[model samples]
Target: MSFPDEILIAGSGPAGLTTALSLHEAGFKVRVFEAVPEIKPLGVGLNLLPHAVRELDELGLLAPLAAAGVACHELAYFTKRGERIWGEPRGLAAGYQWPQISLYRGALQFTLLNAVKTRIGADRLHLGRQLTGFDATPGHGVRARFLNRATGHEETADGRLLIACDGIHSAARKIFYPTEGPPRWNGAVMWRGVAECDPVLDGHTMIMAGHTRVKFVCYPISSQATRPGAQQLNFIAELRYDTTELSEREDWSRAGNLADFLPQFESFRFPWLDAPAMIRAAPAVWVYPMVDRDPLPRWTHGPVTLLGDAAHAMYPIGSNGASQGILDARVLTGCLRHHRADPEAGLTRYDAIRRPATTQIILSNRQQGPEACMQLVEDRAPNGFQKLDDVVSRAELDAIAAKYKQLAGFAIQELNTRPSLASPTA
Candidate 1:
């Protein structure tokens, strides 16, 4: 079998960009097609877990990310009334080799984009080129068709392998499952925003409040705002609602009405932080129905494969959305490096390693995400915590949280002891 010289990657989000950079470093010439005319900072916040941070650090992106992102130290939970329930250490405090990061989604994406442009060269990335369809020959290679998002002109390109990193509404994914619909909405609507506010817990914290009926997760993303006493805080408020109307928006940056959401959170005034006031101050809010797709039996079809949300669009409850995508990049690059002579075997290997791992996370997010720990406390303390030990033992709670870390591949113990995947020397 002969190996093709170039690889084509569709999408330039964290997963796609990371894949491009890794392949470029492994001596593969790679090109990335992004649907947007320009890749700007678009999303609100991202929680880079320790496992993802270690990968970024090895890629030499930690310093720039640290400069722009907030190093989260702790995550705490409290009741709507204002009683503390559970708190846990994060990053180095939790004993991981790398620190946990919380930053604007745009900042992280831009940082990765800049690194890609520098190492892979600007010419390699084609912005505004939207993927429309593709053709693949088992041993020959894969050819992808794309439309210029800006000029509406169509073009075709060929490469050794084509990866669909085009995100949740992936054209490639739909081609694989033409009869399938949009992402499955889980009967919950979400309103997310980043607002300027005074510091809350620890002045450097990530907090999740409320229950399944109505919930709010808030955390600081950046602390050095020009305005005094103001920090850039990112939040997501979730409520029980039907998602039939949510599949209408084609764009993530779409606007949602406050009147439709504020009622549930209106009286959620914690002594530590006033949820309603913080939400009301947000200049813009992005509303979407919380959703996930059932894991596909496969992500590879001949020379074509999937990455990120295209493969597994899980709920954001566990903060693993971006982290899992970054993980996919690492595993995919590893397989390509090890099986250079056999691209089919490489794709199969990539699926074997990542598909099951990400599927576990997707299902975990649905059932026992980070917020589940808080739910246990809420169930025990129906009347609020007068005696914290009565509801659940601290040791027991710690064990539950630790189990999640282990499953998500971010337990401090695993990071300190686990062996690294073979780095591509190609």
Candidate 2:
């Protein structure tokens, strides 16, 4: 009738790996299972907002993260016609205690992976094991089953609780909601590519050009991806289609044809960055439907729960997806530590706090989150405008950005003054 002092986790993505580090720091045993036999720098770039960065800082990873990627100095928006609509300082520039780190998703993943290996011990990671199912007995905790992908053999792992961070197509999510269906597609296709190019805007700026239906997001993830003067820029070109059929495959690793979405952004040329030219120069491109699952009413079920894309797979708007998962790791670990005497209650508490928070974000991203400003300008001035403030008022822009930051839990003042989710108990 006591806590087992051990935890089992599935999927070593940012969420699971961060959970390992957080829980281990809180003095618990954690074993992480990853589906891939080897974890490499696979995906393209992403941003870790100031709030998420703060959590990593608590874990003493700020130095390494700063070393890995660029700390974005600004987030600027533009119309499809290539005129600046709204621009604001970001990270430390905006006064947040932590800077928003823009690095390749793989770089961030390996950052978490390396910390886990060093802090949690390399032996604790079981690669090539995919979660098949799990059974949680009333008093015996949870016994989870996984397929050893390398050997094609079944293996079982037992722990006081199980956390699933296996990503959008999560196996743990399937076991819970067998009828949930695939991630809801917004009928928009996203073509993502990373190219080493001359710096666009400022080398440290993240820019979103265009509006709701058609948009281009670009930023430099690493200056080190290439030689001096050229930076590694990750870009996503998105276009909405009026079709219900998901004709193209939806895998994140699916290769995409440049001919498809590149033509739409042919006019995305500005004095600073030429969108079409950048796309053509890219060595590779990946396409996937812009998709997210509807928020679940619950994430924790007894001793089992979900994290990251498993719990809330949201559209990547306002640069908040990975940041939310990192927040989840800190809160989940903090809750369990607070409720050490009743760990199951901790799962419920973590669910209560994070689920509602992420649900709001998922719904907001559907409506374009803070990026709605671009759509507003596109609607009013489709032909482009001479003066930026004439299209959208400064007050309106401020409101949009403020609302999202507040909802996303990174409002400058609030986040700067908020207490750490990493409990001081440990």
Q: Highest TM-score among the candidates is held by which one?
A: 2
Over the stretch 1-426, how does candidate 2's per-residue lDDT look in tens digits? 444557999999888888999999999899999999998888899999999999999998999998899999999998887788888999999999899999988888888898999888989999999999998975458988999998999999888999999999999899889999888888888899999899997798899998878999999898885577999899999998887567654798999998888889998898888999989989999998888999998899899999999999999988988999999999998898888877888889999999999999999999999999999998998987888777789999999999999999998988998788867322
Query: What are the clashing pairs of model 2?
Result: none
Backbone clashes counted, model 2: 0
TM-score of 2: 0.97
The sequence of per-residue lDDT tens digits that candidate 1 reaches over residues 1-426 is 454568999999988998888778777789999998888899898899988888888788999998888888998876656567678888877888888899999999999999998998999899999999987888778878999877788998888899999999999999999888878777888788988999886767898887765788899898878689788999888887644455474456878789988888877796788999999889999987887898988899888999999999998876889988888888788888888888768888888888998888888888757667667877777667778788878888777677778778887877877655426422
Task: Provide the global lDDT of candidate 2 against the true structure.
Answer: 0.90
- Stretches > 4 Å off in candidate 1: 1-4, 242-247, 422-426
Worst 10 residues of 2 by lDDT: 417-426
Task: After superposing candidate 2 on the true structure, give the runs of residues whose Cα lies further than 4 Å from its correct spot.
Answer: 1-4, 424-426
| Superposed Cα deviation of residue 309, candidate 1 (Å) | 1.0
